[model samples]
Target: MIKKLAIDDLRPGMEVVQMSSSLWEHLPNLYTQPGPIKSEAHLKLMREQGYQHAFVEVEVPGEPLEKRLDAILADRMKDAPIKERVPFDKEIEVADRAYKSAMNHAHRLINDAKMGRKVDFEGTVETVDGIVNSAVRNPDTLLCLSKLAQYDDYTYGHCINVSAIAVVFGEFLGLSRDELTRLGVAGMMHDLGKTAVPERIINKRARLSSAEFEEIKRHPQYGYDILKRQGDVPEDVLEAVRDHHEKFNGKGYPANRHRSDTSALARIISLADVYDALTSDRSYKDAILPNKALAIMYGMRDQAFDPLEVQLFIKCLGIFPSGSLVKLSTGFYGVVYESNPNLPLMPKIKIILDQDLRPIPSELVDLAARQAVGDENLEILECADPTDYRINLKPYLTRTR
Candidate 1:
């Protein structure tokens, strides 16, 4: 009998054959590989498991006819971990530095406004520009840091998240490095007016009363006033920060600016802000998954969002982003780990369970190329929310290299 092993149980010198998820349990013998398959075999096993799949310790043969499999394994053992090259820690350090610097100026301005003291708008602009330049010069560093949601204060965290997201979007839009930096600054300062609002309304855990909501709407004007006094911010950035909420249908507040009145960057910032807000957990509402949030935003395109910009956002992030849950055609649940830019719709995934939600040994799957021919039914079925299945993504999302 071929002893059944979970996906992680796979190791060096293990002989195995590829089988569909359904067949893995019922007909173990149906899939069999000759003994002691090395490195290429491990890669094959991962593909056989699913698109862009992975497992532990299986060494299949390499391409280009290596001299010895043992030598290759020895070489790999000497190589550094992937995370080391990615430098996540360094990225976090940079983001923390930027955040701390920006927050100091922001909070001080808030305090001044609260005390009825004149605001130092130039100082705030300078702080925002400093952070934006740091991110634009080293985009990947900030992107790595974006994975952290819980830092000191939720407000400051939100600000950093919004800035990171805007930079990502700006990159996708093909903005130049300098342009991305400016746009990022605009994103960081987008909510500057919120400082003028009372903490009671800003941090309210419950639904806001109508009057409170009305008060909340005035933050845009407050932000505009602060920016206007400073005189350093570009017109487009100021407009985006102040009028992001305005809609095409003229139902938005403050001035109810229409689509025709809003600038392109303002529209993009608005869309990014709303998308991030919906996907993030908040005081009064549970977080929605990115896929569902995208769907909701798609539904609102043309009314609240620019239809073209929404489509571009979708293109930038893919159908299911990294850290999303999905269901495969073979009736298995998996988490998307990385998306191949060359094949956006098909990403590398790690299988976690079967159709009934029972835990199974994890496997890696790459949807772009099927592991075995005539296995069309094993293709991806659809995207799913982990929340719908009560699956927590934190562990997988935080998995180290």
Candidate 2:
């Protein structure tokens, strides 16, 4: 049986089935590959590397690794903060203005970097401040708005989205106001190195050749160099820009630093960066829905992402985040207006179409309450693509709750 055992409990001759967490991937000197535990030295090394548990093949009876990990993740989700739900109407207005301002600043920063000109640090700070303040007031508002991806000017929109997401995630983690601002700035500039890459490579629609891929990977270092030359950027912000692509397993590009060596801000921005990139529509591929994106990320935990951060993000957004279109067992279609982390499967939805698929006046429905009242038919059936249903999600996304 495969069982999760504390590093201290590991004994000589016990076979290591696999590393429970991908965080150990970078330390080849400690664990070259999963195999029999040699001695107490191995256990001590793992502890020094910050590993608390490992999956081992033992004669002792136990549950599967997957089931154990799922239980641990569920328990962690419970610890996530449950804030009072603010009315979307009050938050959306501030979010809209903050989003536009951040987008405008991002565009200018990218253009300036491309032209080899110095970035306007003060202006960048102001843009990030607006985003931080808005997130502090009502994270769901900006978070919901950030999901409306635009394809034409993806770079600007993506930066703004990442910044907004990073701030919200940081706030959810109980970061101080100053820390939130720094995280927002880091997210805004995380991809600044892409400006130095040729436009042809940046806009390529086909699969990139090996050489092209290597060239693209250099952006992190290029971004670091560019920012360092400017002389005023904070070290944490620079670290995030340089190492945002670094994975938990130390397999990421540029420096290939392990999770232990990477800064917290870089780790947070990395998750936000991948989330936005996967969910946003691009010329190369159609956008995946938010829930699908989250699932994909969940599978990458301990490998491409920190396991805790991945779970926290899922808790923050729930299974179906705001702006997702879902069908109900009652034969109605609605857009998710907000999530109830405690009841991820049953979020607050805005019903826009009736059973026959005809347009109807929008109405708010709390599936959690419906389920509590014994309305079995009110459960969410599945998430539906807005395009497939001929639904314009933009209207519902912008409408006040």
Candidate 3:
């Protein structure tokens, strides 16, 4: 039933199989592989953009798209042997500097947007590139810094962290250096549309009313429009801003798009954005521990995120993600210092409290080397909240070994 039809003949509910058949030569990336036209709004966008016609699949439905999406996810989730080229202890200092520079750049992007100054959409190249280099060398160092440095400036902090987390995850996915850098830039710019929202709404400490919620949902489109006007923003970055909240089930905001309509980078950033938001402190709610956050996200798989993406994200960050505190099966308390990607459960731990649960000088121990060292085998029994133990992890995470 696939047939070429003039754009006027197409209507809501028709499935656009492909643009390659005719017209749509310069369509946006998201429209390249159009799905069911969900609304008149979608048709409006298509018609306004001069889409002359589309190859629509009429009446006949099949499982091919679903099977294709599964295959794409399978290819992406292949594990790469990502080694720490530079030791965490040695790279922490360098990562700290890069983290700071990126934070400053995030602030600059916001300030320029608010002040009506011309933003250098291309300027993010160097800022995110710095993070890409550090994360590739030792991913844990940047991740550790992101967790420990939860600043009062939650918006900017969030932007930089999402970028950093995305870079770390991109590296684990074995993306090329260029792709990682662009993903970083996308993360940094993902929330730029919030600048158009009122400060009161963005920082409100209470639940947003239904009216306010609707306004907030406009942020993705707002961000996309803002960047589109800037003229040089990459398509990947624009897609991330506009589609990061989109769910696999087509219930998410801005476009109600499913996984098939979204770019892979947007899907990846969506995971990073939610992970950081779940684990980082915000004015509206206390932050959940990393392990608990991962568990919650894992529970939401298929409903909100891709199941394979969640599984691999957990593998990349580890069960006991870096910079989170945990209690060992040995009855001692420690901070997870770095993830062993191959062995997710057995990470490098730094014991900060004695078995008695009393404060002690920190000792670094590799869980993977337990048998060789002749020490008692240890496993993380549970994740502990930092508030519960009154621990500040910054000093422990940054100290050079």
lDDT scores of the candidates, listed in order: 0.61, 0.79, 0.80
Q: Tens-digit lDDT track for model 1 on 108-163? A: 65566566556544344445555555544443344334433345655665665676
Off by over 4 Å in 1: 1-148, 151-153, 205-209, 329-333, 340-344, 350-365, 369-378, 382-401
Ranking by TM-score: 3, 2, 1
Considering summed lDDT, which 10 consecutive residues are worst modelled in model 1?
Answer: 51-60
Per-residue lDDT over 183-274 for candidate 2, one digit per residue giving the tens place of the 0 to 100 score:
88889988899988989998988889999999999999899999888765767778889999999999998878998888777888988999
In candidate 3, stretches whose alpha carbon ends up further than 4 angstroms from where it belongs are 1-84, 356-358, 372-376
lDDT (Cα) of model 1: 0.61
- Candidate 2: deviation at residue 363, Å? 0.5
Model 2 per-residue lDDT at 129:
82
Better of 2 and 3 by TM-score: 3
Which rank order by lDDT, best down to worst?
3, 2, 1
lDDT of 3 by residue, 1-401 (tens): 34446778888998876332222444442244568988899889988886767656555244432344556457646654556488888888888898888888788899987776656554566678789889888999878888998575988899999999988987877676666767888899999889899888887878899999999999999899898887556666788789999998999989999988987678888999999999987766889999899999999999899888888888889888899898998898988898887777778989988776787887898988884587656888888888776778878878844
Clashing pairs for model 2 are 22-302
Any idea how many clashes model 2 has?
Answer: 1
Per-candidate clash tally = 19, 1, 0
Candidate with better lDDT, 1 vs 2 = 2
